[model samples]
Target: MIDALHIPDFPMQRTCPFDPPQEYAKLRVEHPVSQVRAPTGQIAWLVTRYEDIRMLLNDPRVSADRRHPNMPLTEEVTPQTRRNIAEVGRSLIGLDRPEHGPRRKMLMAEFTVRRMAAMRPHIQHTADELIDAMLAGPREVDLLTALALPTPTRTLCELLGLSYDARDIIQRSANAQLRRSVSAEERQQTSAELRAYVDQVVREKTAAPTDEDLLGRLVLSNRETGLYDHELMVGLTMLLLVAGHETTASMIALGVTGLLQQPEKIPGIVADPAAAAAAVEELLRYFTVVDALPRVAVGDIEVGGVTIRADEGILLSFASANWDDEAFPDAATLDLARPARKHLAFGYGIHQCIGQNLAREELHIVFRTLFSRIPTLRLGADLDDLPFKKDSNIYGIDALPVTW
Candidate 1:
């Protein structure tokens, strides 16, 4: 029987900085599916096996519905929850079934092969320009501030046709939104500012809609059908802006740090595009930045040989799944050449990251260009001394100090 009082805390601490919490390995062996006390003090099942998480994500009985009373949350229970649902509507992250399918199909049009191909050149040019500026300046710099942060900030601007001049507002609001350290009021305020900014841009695009950018394309294609109105467009765009910016920036910074720790892996990756792409997959799996995907059981289901009752909350542990030896051989060691596509980095199932294609383009270009341009680049600080973003739900390096 599952013990209630002895339930482990949902988000276990990492004994080592880079590797996941050691508890996952033990749990996978003894209790792949087990109960844990959430930060909200509610009990939820934490699923640590790869096969189980993949199956549940595709299962009809599972749901991403944030409105579910039993859904586990990373943040502590607060007034912010109700306010967010009221203001944000059923975002792409929370939608299910009939609503989810069409919405995702409609948005996927923006990230089509032809569109990503066209945007690739612009992404490449932006990375090169950023490198030129960094090289022209001081030898010592924070990679987080220099290349990692601005590359995504500007690329998203170009993709959406937003004004680059407003990067301060965009970057500031995005950086603040995900931070657990910030008060609920502060996060709400930042979210409002970002939404208001996107709303302004949406209105501008609607007045003179064009097919030149993602936002413009959406406005042109959907406005005629009355399918995507002003408010919906603003909310969706705001989610894209915040989600795309913070996570990718964090990945880039963290990826660079991870690469430097094993400089031997750096040359083979930076020297070839194919190698870089493969290395990207390995890095994605290794970090598995977002620790777990929050879900709630819709009906009774037997998983990992145990029965979970309906309406009970569950967390699909991505970090644990990615590191499972059954799925990934020698998962502890970072092998850049590993056929790691099966990993759940962007996530699995319908609600998987919408901006994933865009993220790939940014990461591919940024990683390749930075190291190729500055061969002498080396870390400015030791890994033990560097600050990590443990407080944020999105795990990454807070700052990457380096010198070339």
Candidate 2:
């Protein structure tokens, strides 16, 4: 074990706003699984290598339950707050084994490859409509607001049976939840507000349910089989609302920025629909918006030539793993044609993103439509001045100013 005083901090600071912390690259090369201190002052194992991260992610001995007292929290959570999240948080992302499997199975059909494929036309149309509005509005506009934010927000709201009017409030709350700078008290309050809104919507849907939308389907199915209850419905929809939009919204902004930096690839991605899919995968691997995933070792586990003792917290660094040279040769270089589908951007194993199929479909349509329609698109601001979401759990630019 590394000396407690010598352990590097887990969420290391970044030198460049666009890249992962330099420590991650160094650690991946030197110590693949090194002990580190978290923001919460808890010492944990920071797993950086691609092979080790994938192994640990799939290992049953690693638990995703955030309420574990020794869990390495990126954000500080009071015991009461932890209880609130564990009890009321119906997020499949945070559950393990028996509890997680059944809950995920219930919603798996909604995001299956076939189901997402069937919705391609609608996604395409939504992308087209957003781009059409962007073109008509102004030559110089903030793409993040004009397109990146709305495309996913509109699509997720439609699927979740949420009102478009609630988008602003929901987005605000989700932002607070992921931001590192937000105080624990403020985060708890925002979470409560979000839960309150979801509670109202779930209750309304339960009283008068239909199978037309995802949330409605869940409600109707629950009524039939008693598989879920009102609180579970609230938690599930809240998870969907935040996960469904924030992650994809961040991708749109960052993906567009990345494409603009390498304009030569724009034509290829825009010209060929099949190539756009590949480009999306490459972009996901290159950017890796979400930084790390938290897990706790439930049993003594060994990986990357290191042993993580039972009860030790672990942070699987997605950004570091994606850049592992062993996994992707010349990993730092972004190649649209490179087969990058194995990247952990969407994660791996059972806890892998449930909304991945939907996210990918959205990305394919958005990138294809945006570039095809605005073939002359270019950045309106200097790269250095751009504000990146350095403080948020999800990495992305705050706004992407663009002009054709």
Candidate 3:
């Protein structure tokens, strides 16, 4: 094991756009479960191997509760920042044990394969409309605004029965929360903004409730229960938006960028269901945008021949694991037909992304329609000049300029 003096800083810089920081490859074999200082200046374990990452995430001894005093913080926290963490706990991502299971089960009712299949036509229509509008306007435009951002934003807004016009309100706060470069006060401010936005929507629903959409349905069914309480529902609504919107939006843009680099591989991605599914899975693993999935070790657990003591913060590196040579052969090379569905891109176990089905459908339809209709599509900007979201908690491009 490396000495404490050499422990690297957390969220190491990525030297390659297509790969993680090379330092991860060194740690994967040498110090698989190693400690690093977070931006908050607190020590946290960085788990890098695929097998160990999978094991620990599925381990019950760890907790996802952000309220844990020792849970990883990417930035320094103030009293209000601690309050922000507590408030964020109301979301499903930060819940643990009893609260997590029941909450996830309730939300899972809306994300079943059947339910997602039903949304295919709607997603397709949305994709086509955006493309039609984009093509009519300019020969060259930023795909981020034209398709990527609006695709998930509009879908999520309509799903929650919120006006699509409120996307600016949703995107602004969501972006702020994902950026570690932002100060704690800024993070706290955005959290409150998100909370307030959700509260207003729930209030309007409570005043005139109907079973037409998710917000309305939840309100109608849990009228006399805590599940429908104003605060809880606001948290739940915010969770759905935070979980569903930004990540998928990032993936859509990055996925197109990746495919554009390998044009010969585009047909396979658009040709058939099997090929497309494999391609999506490979892209998920290839990128693994959610780089730092935080957990607190609630009990001693031996992983990677290292014992992570109780209360130690853990940041599971899905990026390193997906790219681990032991897990996926030739992990650096993107092979769409390699049957990569088992990759940890959506994560593993209970805390895995609750909105995976919706995300998958959105990406599948968006990519299929975008590439097919705009067969001549190519990057309008030089690949080297493109800005990557290295500073944000989510890994993606800031913008993708494309033209056919």
Candidate 4:
């Protein structure tokens, strides 16, 4: 039996900088599904193996309901929990089945393959404009500001029919919510402000409703089918606004860092779109940035020879699963040709990212355009001097100093 004190802390920081927590590598081989103490002072099971992570995430019996008393949180129990539920309610990611299915179905229609295909031209244009600005600005620049951050923020605003000028408002609110370093009081206040802002936008869209954008369509849906309400729209909008850009922004920065590390592989990817797309998948797997997918067991379930009793919390390590040697041989090495579609980077099951198509398109456009334009682009600072986000739930560098 693993000693309670010896059980590695959940969400351990990466020791080797670019790699996932070293504890994950050891746990996957020695005890794939081991119990651990959370930062919140609760005991929880940490699932590290790829098969176990897939099984639990796909299992209907497992609950994503964050309201559950037994749910394990990486953060300490705080007043913000109750305030969040009261003010904004659960976003799409936090809801369980029955409530989850219809809401997801309604939104899925908006993110279909055809919709992403239609957005390709705009995504391409956005990438080109950003690159033009970056190239003209300076020999030394922080890439996160010039390209990685704005590309998705602007795209999401356009897709939702919101003002690109509101990027400051949206980004500030989003950063407050995502960063673990922020105080609960501050997070709650910012979250309230964000919801109010979205609610106002929803009201405006409802007043002068258009069918062209996601928010406008949802407003139209509420009127036609009577299936949604203002609160639901606000929740959905808040989710899309934050998630739509923040995660992709993190990926862009991290992806570029990963590619710069293996500069020899850059040529093949830059020359061929097909090769670049393949490399994008590999990059997604390599930097599995999301730290953990939290869930609580509603009923007894057997996984990896361990009985997860009712009410026991489970944290699925996406980073660990992506790095599993069994799933991807020599998993540590960056192989641009690896078929990484099966990786858990976008997650799995019904709750898998609805924006995967859009995200994939954006990544393809950004990587191809950025590298092809600035063939001499290289890191401006020493690797050790760069500030990586070890504390944030999303893994990425604070800024990428680049010189071309």
Candidate 1 per-residue lDDT, tens place, 31-113, comes to: 99999987777789999999999999999788887887777876653566445643344657777787778777878988887
List clash counts for every candidate, in order: 0, 0, 0, 0
RMSD of 1: 1.8
C-alpha lDDT of residue 272 in model 1: 86
Question: Cα deviation in Å at residue 143, candidate 1?
Answer: 0.3
What would the per-residue lDDT of candidate 3 be over residues 65-153, giving only the tens digit for each residue?
88888888776667786766666566577887777887677777777898778778888999999999988987999999999999999
> What do the candidate models score in CA lDDT, each in turn?
0.83, 0.84, 0.85, 0.84
Tens-digit lDDT track of model 2 for 1-404: 46767887767877776678988888887788898888789988889999998988889999988678887778776666676667544457678888888788888978888877877887888888878788778699999988888888888887777788998878888888888889889888888888888889888888888878888888777666676877777777877887778899999998998888889988988889778999999999999988788889999998888788899999999999999999999998888889999999999998888888889989988888888888999899988888887788888888888998
Cα displacement (Å) at residue 91, model 3 = 3.8
Alpha-carbon shift of residue 125 in model 3 (angstroms) = 1.2
Q: List the residue pairs that clash in candidate 4.
A: none
Clashing pairs in 1: none
Runs of candidate 1 exceeding 4 Å displacement? 85-89
Q: Is candidate 1 or candidate 4 better by lDDT?
A: 4
Instruction: In candidate 3, list every pair of residues with a backbone clash.
Output: none
Per-residue lDDT of 1-404 in model 4, one digit per residue for the tens?
58866876777878876899988888898888899877777789999999899988878889988777667777643566444643343657777788878778888889999999999999989999989988788799999988998999989988999999888878887777767787767777878888878889999998998999988887777686665677867877888987778789989998998889889888899899888989999999999977687789989999877899999999999999999999999998888899888999999987898999899999988988898999899999998889998767778888899998
lDDT of 2 at 175: 86
The alpha-carbon lDDT assigned to residue 228 of candidate 1 equals 69
Range of the 10 consecutive residues with the lowest summed lDDT in candidate 4: 81-90
